[model samples]
Target: MAKKQHYKHNNGAMYLMLSPYLLLLFFFGILPAIMGVLEIPKPSMANANGGWDAFKIVIHDFRFGPALRHVLGFMGIFVPLMIFFVIGMALMLDIKHSPWKKWLRMAYIVPASISGAVAVLVWYVILQPTLSPIKGVLRYFHITESSQIWQQQNLVYILAIMAFFAAAGNWILIQYGSLQSISTEVLEAARVDGASVWQTAIRIKLPLISKYIVYMSVLVFAGGLQIFVEPQLLNGGIYQGIADSWSFDQLSYNLAFMQGDFGGASALSILLLIPSLLGALLVIFKTDMFEGAQGHIKKKDVEIVGI
Candidate 1:
């Protein structure tokens, strides 16, 4: 009877500890998500027929398809490259006996401390048409009279590169943490068994860290989907080659603030939520990550019969 009362008291304390976070999530996360799906009038409803009609107009606008395509294209180019580079750097840093490892790790993580918007601004200055370092190089080589790299479609690739440079450091830290959690004894046994570094990485390290890789991939993909500040700050938030609404987040921003169509923005926001929610579900269910079932299967059955 005393133990039962003690257990109940502990449970009450635990609930009290969790109440703040639960309340915060309820008000900020759940409430906003529910409100986003609810039908609301556009601020410009008087000017544009009605809320539903305003939403339709925004959806059917000429820029919608092209903007979505541009964002998707940028994600396609950036996410995979960042994942590969971050994982590789993490592996390199995970070498415990390497010289200068501390400095190398610090260098990799330094970019993560910088804000995304600030990083974009710095890159914009570096990649400007006239004062760019590349421009100086080209001029020295007599390659062209002016720097036109930022004017062409190639600017998308440059933007992707800048994003990778700014964000890859944080991902490298995540991957490194996962790598460090792996058992050193297993690696030593593999080395004693004459397994080469490449072979061990492929067969052991990669398999062990597969779940972390998947998690990072999903997280980065979702983040890439919501990209705004980098492109907006870099391109001056105009409808130029890459428009103001190039990303889904930017689309919602343009609808609500620029066009005064809150209903349309909410609809677009709900659409954006779908991909992120689906990606999260996939990470939770489709992968062996959350359940710790990656490589725990044991005992394969074998049958022998008279031939």
Candidate 2:
């Protein structure tokens, strides 16, 4: 009984130690969510029955459709491309026999330290027609004029590349660490069983790191849905006919600040948060990411005795 009481006391102390983080989470995450709900029109407001009118206005707006389409389209392209690059780079860097592993990792890690906005801006300059490294090639191909690459119809592709550049390095490092955490004994046993490099990576390593892939995918998708800065900076904000370039978050921002439609903005914000919240919930429920702080199989304790 005394030991159990002591354990309960220790748990209480640990939670007390975590009070700061809990407070931050409450203030920034929970408080804002409550505020967003409160910002909705009351039953006596112009809506007369509550926020449904705001929801209707936001949902029916022409901007909402295009904003949603752009976010979905960007995610459709960006998520897969980013995942492909992240996994590919991680695998290349994890090559057990590779001489340039350290160099490749350093190169990949460099971009992750750059802010997302700054990375996009750098690409903006690099892909500019006259000043770009590929200026001569673009000119030769007649793809260069006074205009920049983001000004073209292929802005979607340009955005994908920029998003990948900004985000994939962090994911690569994550996947690489997960891959490194893989038991070498399992890998050696596969090699002994005549597993080629491709076979090992595809059949063994990939499955082992599936959890990390799923975690990164959910996070990337969530973040991609709320995309704002790249499109805002790229298109110079709120184009009339080209609303597809503006994201939902940008639309919400414009509604709140640019037009002072607080109710409408709140509706849009709640809508935008739905998928993000779902993704976060899925991560929390589906992964061991939050539990016990020990999820990955340790290489040291792994044995190859059976095979």
On lDDT, the candidate that comes out on top is 2
Q: What are the lDDT scores of the predictions, listed in order?
A: 0.72, 0.75
> lDDT per residue, candidate 2, 77-196, as tens digits?
999998888898788777774766767767877877665668666776677686777788778777665454445456567777778777887788889999988898999999899998
Query: What 10-residue stretch in candidate 2 is worst by lDDT?
Result: 298-307
Superposing every Cα of model 1 onto the true structure, what RMSD results?
7.4
TM-score of predicted structure 2: 0.82
Residues 163-201 of candidate 1: C-alpha lDDT, one tens digit per residue? 788789888888888888789899999999999877877
**Top candidate (TM-score):** 2
Per-model TM-score, in order, reads 0.79, 0.82
Residue 114 error, candidate 2, Å? 3.5
Clashing pairs in 2: none
Candidate 1: list runs displaced more than 4 Å.
1-16, 40-59, 129-147, 237-242, 288-307
